[model samples]
Target chain A: MEKADHLSMKDEPEVQGEPTKTAVHLSTKDRPKVPGEPTKTGTSMVDTAAAAVQSFAPLNQIHQHLCAFHFYAYDMTRQVEAHHFCSHINEDMRQCLIYDGPDPNARLIGLEYMVTEKLFMTLPDDEKKLWHTHEWEVKGGFLFMPGVPEVMQRQDLEKVAKTYGKVFHFWQVELGHELPIGLPNLMMAVTRDGQLYPEMIKETEKQFGISIEKERESRAYMKGPEHGIHPLANGGGKGLKLELREVDIKPVESVPRVFV
Target chain B: MASSGDEDQVPPGDPVTVSTLVIDAGTKIMQRRLPVKQMNTHVSTFAIYGGDMSRQIETHHYIHRVNDEFLQCAVFASDHSDAPLIGIEYVISDRLYENLPQDEQKLWHSHAYEVKSGSWAYPRLPEVVASPELKNIAKTYGKFWCTWQIDRGDKLPMGAPELMMSPQGVGQGVLRPELVKRRDEKYNISTDELKQRRAEIAEPEWINPMADYWKQHGKCFVLDIVTVEMNRNEKFP
Candidate 1:
């Protein structure tokens, strides 16, 4: 079988003799004046300068990319594809910055923090409801991390299966907002069949050249959360509703030790 | 997939005889780029919690300039390769910031002090190449959040996220001498010297009073998360 063209892009990072560089001239007068040109150029030039001296220690750790879908807590009917660029802080937790697509032009939509079940239980009841479980996304093969082998995936998926994530999205792409204008919205993951758009699943499968059915079969034996998901999680099946209210920032005790 | 059985198929006398390498060589690699790959710029600075100015953390920002209107960064605890990602910051031009409602404006802070005090650093860039751009960033506003307080030595990012403020005026903005001295030693650049170089860039007179609320109004904003009925006869807060 001929592999999917886009899937080949992930499987093979660089193609030999394919002349990847392309340069084109632009007629600036033909279009409306674009904004922020100076900053963009400044970034490129400064990044070039910084690249010679400073090391990007933390960013270099983001090697894993997971493809999944998310729903707005206020309205589960609105869902979107979420691509996660993640790194492990430790076995107990992982943090990820999410974007709309995997390509260079993708929009950065939000971020997420995933914690172990042990840690999840430590949270206050109110805080726990803000998070969603990942058992279905993993065991049902709704979530996939590309480029790694099945062996490596199974190893990580085992841990991911038991984790819970709290996500916030700044961009309302589903609402057709041109810019990220409003307050960030809380995002949740669909827990069962028919919740996620099936078309997205089919599209993800086509683009990655993988089988969700096969993945589900292999992950069937993995354990779910030991005590089952807390009732408070996923809005307690009450349809999570999010709101922003003003709260006072409390003061922390001053550090007694002075910086000498 | 690279096969263990293909170990013998590697070209004879090859210095690195790996089964995976042989398979990779046969299939070749493709050039595929990602959005995060364009995140080449790095800025190092410090931020204080909005609710309390005493709680501060050193921030390393790897920026991806989306356009003229916004520059978002993935923040880390340290400059080390394995440093934890402590939070995220969304920066915007003064024009875009001015358009935001008064309440939304409170969530952001100004960068004039960070710039004027010479506290922000461009790490590898020479002062000459960076100063011009730093001048532009000096007038901008930033909304930063620290998911986990690395300074407090938390093992995990627990509790709700904290909204961070940039040190502003003299009484409200003085950073600990130790933090300054340590940052200078790591980058080997004197804040005093950078301060002098940046003095010519006058502060923006139009800084919104709504911004840097902790500094201006003596209070800070906190995240309020709650679950209510979605279809209730009500409007969003």
Candidate 2:
């Protein structure tokens, strides 16, 4: 694969003497007449050099390594709905684009981020409270990597099952609001079975044409010890121990403002 | 006035107590007439952009909540009560960050590392208040661009907006000692000591890939016309 070739070639000394593309806009006639003088045109030598650096093949490898996955998420606070298309920046982090629906014209709702368990554990206890673990989401078959081979999907779930996600919903579209309004509400993943309404899951299953039971069966081997905890017991399973402390400050008048 | 050479120490005393008035419903309560609503005030420091990177400026962030979507923080350089307003930083949830256009998204920086590593802190606020605030801030992203390069000795804000980024994976030597010394004297806190305290804050194995964009691409000054103009004006060629 071209990606594999790029990775393998990373350690090798860069091959020199490659033909460099010159800016066609700057002809020989436009070159500085004097040896040490500046070019007459508005474009400086720095601009030319910057354009060269941008076209370098090595830098593009970083962009090429990105991978995408699909997931269904519900707001932890309210019964608001969301679907996510996450792009993995690396093995450690993924940035997801949340959409109201799976359709092309779906309103972009918010963003979610997933990080490895190692990274999640490094967060401060309070910050840790904001994140929801993926154990139940993966094992219960709520999260899926759509359009991949079953085996590959299983492998992806195995890795994802060990990660934690931080999500926020800007637009409360479920409330029939066309625009994003209010302070961004912190959204958490439904880590337990009963945490999410059964009807929502059924609706999602119907829309995706997949059975959650079958998904769970396919990913059964990926289940770890963490999933053994009963969802209803112990504050909704192993990793869902987040409790937001109440702020005692009085609510003041709402500030009038305009968002750029 | 505290100088860079001063060895300032934080006074050993109890935490200051704040008192609030209790008003009974039968008593008349006085209220001030205001045209607009008030915003929560937050204080922090930012290492300024300029010569040798030796300047740290105190900033007061007046945060205006725009519903549940985002907060717009008007950042002012708080050298005095009536300090000069430097810039505005719009903070949005990661959800909003994702909805932003690809090019627009590149401008925002994640605060997870900043808060967790203790690089960004609230010096005045109690730990209890600050910790939860940081926890909420951790989930969001900020787009901060300063028009003024005060540390560089710019009397007024000039040129295009220069993006402000959080310091990450930066060592003690990377910071200008004189600036740190001055800021330490003013705040009665040591950057070296803070760095030592935060030494155990392990960096996450996975960081947002774009977080390092400035570090990687910032060295290429040839792309910026302002740099070229400055270099030409200074006869650096």
Candidate 3:
């Protein structure tokens, strides 16, 4: 996990004056030209034609937008801002599309799914380690529903404060890799005070014209989990990082087919 | 600010909350964006761990084909409107799979059997368009992860995402017959008929041996969180 210190914050430029919280776009340099000449006319024409014929009902149901920050599970200091366009799979669960930013050039870097506490406590010890409690992120003022006000956001925040998320980040944007070049890495959320860089929080507050202090105060009355945070979760400050290892697929007696 | 119990204690099943009051008072979300409409194709299939076919999962994939060679999908537990989000999968052509480093190749599984066995189906799309697409997809390989192990009845997605493999070949250790029957009945289709219907899709000239390495080698890749270095002070230092 100490490999996390290798990530330098300078890779991602600061969030500037965003007129709206939903303006989660990043300020980055222009793209370098590719060898082939670009042709937008043909692309747009196909998109228009396809739209005239195709059905997009499932995608249409995705409506909620939540923007937050995720750090490489191994490194507490390295962080990336992610915008989640989510839809309810069920009342107990939510699936989201995690993008690095909201710009046209932005990359869809990861996928995160959330579940409430009643379901969370059912996980085994080892399994719990893979999930992070959202209490700190919600109660700590680091997570928000972008354009929604606190009053409207609270109903969901109350539910979220007791939930957990498992994030799989396909792109290592924090490493400054222009392309998604590596296998996915598990990502985590900040669970305690002092872990988030002071300046980073200050920049977001200034850009959005919102105060983290006031956000915490507004959510003060919201209840914390009665069971408390799991000790094995969030790497338990062990500086966790996801890595791949080869293992034998366990041999099992196959269940014979009961029907044709 | 809405005061706590300073007002009457809210009754059971109360329709009015501060949120409803705020909404009733004309608060609105002035600006918002949702860019996920790219997903269009929906296919339902089954997947099993590369190591164990005894444990199987029913998957609902809402896909967006990026180009002739690539596609990404969001996976859910079922086709039921209320199904829980389960995981994600990315499918790539043989050309891309071959170019990947040897170690990376071991992580992916071929879709040939899934297509040929009639296990993978586009339930809603017309067979005319779906047939051509299925033929092209049969030659590709996919790598997926299951976050919520609903098959185990965990109620929530737990643990790190479990890397999944598509069942290749036929019989016993491969896709189970009962599971196939269940899927067939749900969609009002016959696996045996699909097996015959898709029989004409020509098998690719070659599938990388490294792909689906476990079936032959008995080994699979797993996600781990081995502490690379101690963040705290070490005795050696």
Q: How do all models score by TM-score?
A: 0.78, 0.36, 0.75
lDDT of 3 by residue, A178-224 (tens): 43434677778867776665655665666567788889999887765
lDDT of 1 by residue, A173-258 (tens): 54444445455667788687766545556667887788888989999988768888888877565545434445454433343325
Alpha-carbon error at A183 in model 1, in Å?
Answer: 3.1
Q: Tell me the lDDT of model 3 at B112.
A: 89
- Best model per DockQ: 1
Q: Give the backbone clash total of model 2.
A: 10
Query: TM-score for the first chain of model 2?
Result: 0.58
For each candidate, the alpha-carbon lDDT, in order, equals 0.67, 0.42, 0.64
Query: How do the residues B153-195 of candidate 1 rate in per-residue lDDT, one tens digit apiece?
Result: 4555555567788865554456777777777888888988999
Candidate 3 — which residues are off by over 4 angstroms? A1-61, A88-93, A103-108, A176-184, A192-194, A197-223, A226-230, A250-259, B1-33, B170-173, B225-237
Return the clash pairs for model 3, or none: A249-B51
Rank candidates, lDDT, best first.
1, 3, 2
Misplaced by over 4 Å in model 2 are A1-77, A225-260, B1-237
Model 3 B-chain TM = 0.81
Model 1: CAPRI class: incorrect
Candidate 3 per-residue lDDT over residues B23-92, each given as its tens digit: 3233223325434555656777888864355577677787755555666677766655445567778787
Supply fnat for every model shown.
0.38, 0.00, 0.28
Cα lDDT of model 2 by residue, A11-88, tens digit: 323222121121011111111111112222322222233333322121111111111122112122234345554433
Instruction: Give me candidate 2's TM-score against the actual structure.
Output: 0.36
lDDT of candidate model 1 versus the reference: 0.67
